[model samples]
Target: MINYISDHLKNNPLLVLDGAMATELEKHDIDTDSELWSAIALINNPEAIKEVHESYFKAGAKVATTNTYQANVEKFQQFGLNEAEAKKLIIKAVQLAQAAKAEFKADDLLVAGSIGPYGAYLADGSEYRGDYDLTITEFMDFHRQRMQLLNQANVDLFAFETQPNFEETKALAKLLKTEFPQKTAWMSFSIKDSQTLCDGTPLNEAVKYFNDDQQIAAIGVNCTKLENIEDTIVNIKKVTNKPIVVYPNNGDIYDPKTKTWQANPKTSSFKELVPKWIDAGASLIGGCCRTTPADIKEIAEFT
Candidate 1:
């Protein structure tokens, strides 16, 4: 699978797939907030999780991330659990992916452990960056446990996505380089503008931070509009030659009628912008919120 992802990156430049979506699963009648949603949900019903994986696999995904992004210690603490519970959750999510890979004979499906930010995202730009008891040391300790579980799961890669803050993202990178030295790690910084991460660091500066790390396989953007991805990749290209990946949100993120978070409409239609992303040097591509298997199918067939 590693070779497959590596080879695809060599040829296509944009190996696209669907982005990680929790609420979308909930809309499909799965529990988006299940205790297992972070980990156990996949373990409890590998078949159910397999269904999602197969959907994307058939949709032409080169990578399938285990639904472990929210399975972090801090998030489990919100559910009144401790670090041990969080570790178990992460293990379960990994196990479920392992099962699905074998069942579908998806030898080429790269299983990436989805690692989201430790803080909440506010639409108005007010994230939970508290000046309180939990110092960066404490927070990095929490991330270390998650990384351990992902390493133990033997995932092909670690994907730190939706990381709004540069401080937190840098902290995770430091931990991976020191603790999980054997595993490949990638990063996707969410954007507030075409050129800057949500915390306002320019993409070029962010690229400089990860450029020297050999463990980083690919680095790019996720959870932004497709229309903005070409510009982001082009900007990132100015800094490093690392393989670039993008998982853009399906257009129309905010919907008043349904109050949907990632409204799954085919905003900008896949055919139009996918080639643009490829031409701009994107090495990996996929959908985020509101993206479905069909959208992935469109990308695979068209791209």
Candidate 2:
């Protein structure tokens, strides 16, 4: 299988991923406060999703991540989409992103299909806690249908991101190897700190688990605090030689109960930290929650 990220990485040392999708969607006044999250826009307002992709491209992003992060077959069916309808919606996400890239005329740009953890479907923030338990087969069962859809939809690669469970991460990598041999993905975990995954798995241990997987093009963390990213990169490099992918949140504290964000005074400016992250060996850099295209522009400029 051709590693799509390498095509972009060949010319540049780092692949600049786009900023948040749900974050950008919220700015469009789209109500993302639902179980479906950004997938709701795929059902009601797909054009807005496309425009967000274009905005990131305009902001100097080299990749557009499809708005399928929180989308899944069961959730879509629960929200009134038939299985076929849900599948179509997933395919539509890839189309919308591909359309944006084509319109941007950078043919060099790429589209990564977003695959969030099962915890995202639970909608209780377990993705950041990794407390949920599922056997590897169960994890594969829940994720296989969607991965099959994204594979057939022709995504350049899958973005298995914000993964918290080490077992679940194993499931994704195994599924990619046995089922989708033609595809490759980047696996990113949610962390409790620089050295540990949200589930308390040591970052180095989880990272070393798949250090030999050729299908996993990159490995690192996402949706983590800015304060942890620099150290997180150092930790990941200690385990593997794969490309390191890091995209941290804006560092604002989120009160999930109230669905609000409070400023974190100690958080340094995103621009101020870009060089440090790059120097720490982050080959794939971008923004996560609360980050904007402007932040992505900072990374693009610095790289």
Candidate 3:
């Protein structure tokens, strides 16, 4: 019921979001190479997940995105977990973040329940491609269960992140607007470039689609290239007065064939980029893949 993000923004210049979950988990020695990605840690290394959350909080992040990006009942069942067991793991991801908040004793901390796109469950890099097709009902059916679970878990808010498919984004907005009216979310896309979503929807059109929806707390981009953010933020700000939330990858190039992220020395650090994003009107900022708590600390310092 509390708008943790907007409330923070009212008193503070910007809200600081936590960095990567799966990659951050690796630093604690948790294997995240599985199809489940960071969600695997919920079942295998929950303690480490909690530690990562605490690390982000200690590093100055006011928001912790739960380790549920790839966690869904169907995906967990593939590992032989029953429906109830799978659901428990989903909730456990939330509990670990809450436990971390409690351990840190931060009254202002917020836990955002992460809901990745359907492609995330495919684990086929389809999320970046946005080439999947599903009817509205089918899309809602696939996402509803997890949203319901997260809602029941009482997360501070939902983070509909890295969403690519426009139809899927429409479906999620409809689901939230119709069913979870009391809940608030920030919908961030996986953009293809400065002017288009991964699915090829024009950035202005897609951003304008949800511009009037109060249930959507903010709208912008995430899990994208850092170089892609400033222009993308400028584009979104043009169509919507809603706050813009952006957390880009570490400016490393990802290779689909090798599924590895390569560091590019040409990439500018967050210190150089954060000021531009802030100037461009980004209200909440953080890091995505390959970015660590230090990046978040840099963002916090500059903000």
Instruction: Give the TM-score (vs. native) of candidate 3.
Output: 0.98
For model 2, residues 274-296, the per-residue Cα lDDT tens digits are 88888888899998998889899
Off by more than 4 A, model 3: none
Local error of candidate 3 at residue 139 (angstroms)? 0.8
Evaluate model 3: give its lDDT. Answer: 0.90
Record all residue pairs in model 2 with backbone atoms less than 3 Å apart, i.e. clashing: none
Per residue, candidate 1 scores C-alpha lDDT tens digits across 123-161 of 222222211234556557857877788888888888888
Off by more than 4 A, model 1:
1-8, 11-13, 33-46, 77-86, 120-136, 255-259, 262-266
CA lDDT of each candidate? 0.70, 0.91, 0.90
* Decreasing TM-score order of the candidates: 3, 2, 1
Clashing pairs in 3: none
Error of 1 at 55 (Å): 1.0
Evaluated at residue 277, the lDDT of candidate 2 is: 86
Could you estimate the TM-score for every candidate? 0.84, 0.97, 0.98
Candidate 2 lDDT for residue 266 = 89
**Regions more than 4 Å wrong, model 2:** none
